[model samples]
Structures are given as C-alpha cells and as structure tokens.
Target chain A: EAGVAQSPRYKIIEKRQSVAFWCNPISGHATLYWYQQILGQGPKLLIQFQNNGVVDDSQLPKDRFSAERLKGVDSTLKIQPAKLEDSAVYLCASVTSPAADTQYFGPGTRLTVL
Target chain B: DQQVKQNSPSLSVQEGRISILNCDYTNSMFDYFLWYKKYPAEGPTFLISISSIKDKNEDGRFTVFLNKSAKHLSLHIVPSQPGDSAVYFCAARADDYKLSFGAGTTVTVRA
Candidate 1:
C-alpha cells in the first residue's frame, strides 16, 4: 500500500524555459490527476486521466502545457516556455474509482520560475 | 470563476478550544464535499467529508456539516492541538468527477 509518488521535490527554472514533472499513482488506482497550487491558494485541477486516456484537461494551457499517462500507472506533466505565473507547486493525486475516490496526493513538485 | 470560497484567511485558537472553518460554494451540482489538511511541505491529507444527503458527519475529534440550501459547509475541530495547526481546504466534487477547491484557510492552534 504505497502512496502516490512524485519526483523532483523542488525545481527552479527561468521563464520561457521548459520543465517536466513525473508522478506515480498508487497501485490499482484508476484515476490520476495533476493540479497546480499557487502560494496561498488551493489546488487547481490541470488535468485528469483515467488509466491511459485523458478524462479532462479543460483548464490546462494547451499552448504550453501537456501531460500523458502512457501505461496508466505513471504520468508526466510538461510545461514548455514556462511563464512566471507558472511558478507553483504541482501536485499529483490518484484514486481507485470515481465513486470511492478519496484522492491520495503526492509530495508535489514546487516549481519556482524566475 | 472561483466556485468555492474560504473567507477566513487564517485563524488562531488556544489549545483545548474549538476551531471552526467555513466554506461556501456557488454550484448546486456538487454533491460531495471534503476537507483536507496540509502541512508546510507535505501534501494534503483527507480529514473528513460529508455528502449532500447528509447534514453532518463526525469522526473522532473532527466533524463536517453540510448546508445544501445555502451552498455552505464547515469543519469543526474540538480540543484543538498543535498537531491540528495547518492549512485547511474545502473541496467539492460533482458527479462529473471534477473537484473544485477553495482558497484555503490557515489554522493555528497555540498550545
């Protein structure tokens, strides 16, 4: 019963630079989500994946942000030409199902864009 | 559009006292509500939750009350302790599977 795992606990990058974050959901979890948490603000959903397919990504910045859950176990979120406004903690969470999803969150990657 | 709102930015309560956090939502479609607590660096952990059909749900020292008509909900912590000091966030989920979160309220329990 391992929890959700995320890589690169912290990251520092310059505006316009490209960066990527990784996530590993809990075993047997069917739903994976990526969220952006700005300082002093709650997490905002960026994308969600049910297995290897995307369930929702309406809030994602299509021009620069992208994510993929290739094997349905691990996922990655990328931001190219990152903006200063993109400096925030990126969190990954997983759930077993839509009905009983309690959402186990990872430690998150804190990205600082200068 | 900021569907969920946590008015109080922060609260400080003496140990052994009660700590209450409030949240309001504008969407009626949201049927499930949850409360999560987060420390400085760690991820948020689930605290308690109450469905729309239920007015109140309690677990140990934590309790959640939901008001569907007013689109408001609250979390109450009794006998607050230092360990209970953290940022509390209210989240609402609809049948569509999206969770809308509040801005978060920081609670400080001085022991």
Candidate 2:
C-alpha cells in the first residue's frame, strides 16, 4: 500500500512570513494527524482530524497555527507570522481509524524560519 | 512535560551483538506502547507494539518487554545488523488514541 504523502520536502521562510504545508494520507484511512518535531525531540501532536472533523487540537497554538482536512483525504497546516521558533519539521500521519494503533507517517516538510 | 522518555540519547553496538533500548512512561493510563524506527530524512515506521495486558511480545529477532509496575519498557534487538542503525522512538497511547512519544534513542550498529 502507498504511504502518506507530503509536499515541499523542505521550506524556508523569513520571520513574520506565512507558510503552509500539505499532506495526502493513505487511501481509505479515516484518521489524519499533524505533528511538529523540533530538533532532538520526538513528534508532538499539533492536531487530529477524523474524516474532516477535528477530534483534538488542544496542543495547537491557535494564535499562530491552524490545520484543516478537506473531504477527509487531504490536509493542510498553516502557520502565520512565523517565528524563529517555528523552525522544525512538520510531519503528517494517518491511520485506518481513530482507534487504530499503528500510524503511517510521511517524509515531512522541513520548515526553516530565518 | 513529556509522558514518555528515552533517557539514553545514543547507543553503539557491534554487528551480531545484542542491543537493548529502554523507555519510561509517567502515565498509568497509557494502555498501549509502540516502537518506531526512523532514518535520516524519512518519517518513522512502525516496528512493534504491545498491549497492556501482555508483559512480553516477541517478533523474530526483536522483543519488547513491558513492566507495568515500574512504568518501564524495553526493546531488544538480537544480532544487530548494520541496517538496524537508526533512531528508535518509544510511544505510549491513551484511551483517546492520542500518542505520547519519547525523544528517541539513536542506535548505531557497527560492522
């Protein structure tokens, strides 16, 4: 089976600029997720979508970050007014369902904010 | 605070030797634990998993042991191979299906 797919394997932006990352999950998967991985740290959950509906986004910084899944197949994560601290890899993952344990991950978009 | 932690940042072992990586979790509510392997420039791939009810699960040359009372778990790779060199992440899952991950352990298998 084809794995999750993401765009712009790498990105660079200046502080105060906006950036967006895209993700296309595995076909037939019902759950999608966005995560942020800073250097030396593991992936941290940013938001979760269950068939285009948000299931969890408590850890997301609403003031700067937002994410959406359309048609339950593709997703986009956006960061406005990017800061230096926003320099990290944005990873997208998917699972067969919300209750499924094994998650498939994409190559990720490495965002560098200068 | 991170609920899951891999205290050892890195480990080096000779090929054909045993490699053991450890992880500790702070939450008792976590009912499932998983291990993921990652290479440079690539996303993590699922390696193995164990449920709360089981104390040990083994697959081929890999084995995972969970100690509920100690809130600790470990992954053992026997006869490590050069291809096994990668970052290993330990993750815990709650009933909500959200996962908490560790910083990861970088294992280097030397020839």
Candidate 3:
C-alpha cells in the first residue's frame, strides 16, 4: 500500500504572497489531516477532514488559511497573504479511520516566506 | 495552550546504551499516547504507543511507559543504534480525534 503523498517538496514565497500545498492520502484512508511544524517544533494540527467533510479546523487561521478535501481522496491547503511567521513545514497525514491509532504522514512541504 | 511537552531539547547517547526520552501532558483526558520518530526531510513514523489504561508497552527495542496520575510518559530505547538517531515526538489524542504534539526531542546515538 502507498503512503500519503504531497506535492512541491519545498516552496519559497515573499511575504503577503499566496501559496498552496496539495496532499493525496493513502488508499482506503477515511481521515486526512494538515499540520504545521515550525523549526525545532513538532507538527501541530491545522485541520482535519473525514470523508470530504471537515472534522475539525479550530486551529486554522480563518482569516488567511483555508483547506478543502473535495471528493474525500485528495486535499489542498492554501495560505493567502502569507506572513513570515507562516514559514514552516506543512505536513499531510492520514489514517484508515478516525478511530485508528496510527497516522501515516507525507514527506511534507517546506515553505519559506521571505 | 500546548497540552504536550517534551522538556529535553536534545540528547546524546552512546551506542549500546539506553536512551530515555520524557514527556509530560497537561490534559488528563487524553485517551492514547504515542511516540513518533522523524528523520530529516522526512515525515514522522509511528514508533510505539501506550493506551491510557496501560502502564507500559514494548516493541522490539522500544518501550513506552505511561504514568496517568502524574500525566507523564516516557520512551526507552535499548541498545541504541545509529539508525535510531532522530527527532522523537510525544503525542496525545483524545476522543475529539485531535493529536496534540510536543516540541520533540532530538536524540543522537553515538558509535
């Protein structure tokens, strides 16, 4: 079975610019998640989706950050007017179901905002 | 507020020795505890986990100990190998389906 896949291993953008990241989760996986990991920090949950519907997104920055899991197989996370503080590695993860204990993670997209 | 915390920023251990990483949680409601090992440029992988009802769980060379009363847990790696050198993250999950993570501890196994 294939693990979670993410696009654009690395990205660089200027402050106030917009950036987007994509994620394709493992087959048969019913839950997907997006996380942000700042340097020297662990991954922090940004949003979660279960079968095309959002399960939780309380930590997401509604003013500038948004994500969607249309069709429930692939997902995308976008940040508009990115700020310097947004420079971090964005990770995508998945689990077979919401009740599963183990989560498979993707390589992640390292975003650097200038 | 960060619910999980790994106070040690880093640890250096000689090969064939034991490596112990500690984590503390502020929330007592977490149902499961897990540890993840991450390499540079790669995402984290599950190492070992312990449920809230269990005090200890072991797999191969890794063992996880949970102390519910103190809201603390630990991971012990015996006979550490070079491949074991990586950042270790302690995470907790509740019924809300959210995994709260700590600021990982980097462990370097020396030969």
- Which lDDT tens digits does candidate 1 get at residues A1-114? 899999989999999999999999999998999999999889999999999999889999999999999988899999999999999999999999867747889999999999
> Worst lDDT window (10 residues) for model 1 chain B?
B92-101
RMSD each, Å: 0.8, 0.7, 0.7
Off-target runs (Cα >4 Å) in candidate 1 are none
For candidate 1 chain A, the 10 contiguous residues with the lowest summed lDDT are A95-104
TM-score of chain A of 1: 0.98
lDDT of 1 by residue, B24-47 (tens): 999999999999999988899998
Arrange candidates by TM-score, descending: 2, 3, 1
What tier of docking accuracy does candidate 1 attain? high
Per-model i-RMS in Å? 0.9, 0.5, 0.7
lDDT of each: 0.94, 0.96, 0.95
lDDT of 2 by residue, A51-114 (tens): 9999999999999999988788999999998999999999999999978869999999999999
Clashing pairs in 3: none
In candidate 2, which residue ranges exceed 4 Å CA deviation? none
TM-score of 1: 0.98
Give the DockQ (2 decimals) of all models.
0.81, 0.90, 0.88
TM-score of each: 0.98, 0.99, 0.98
DockQ pick, better of 1 and 3: 3
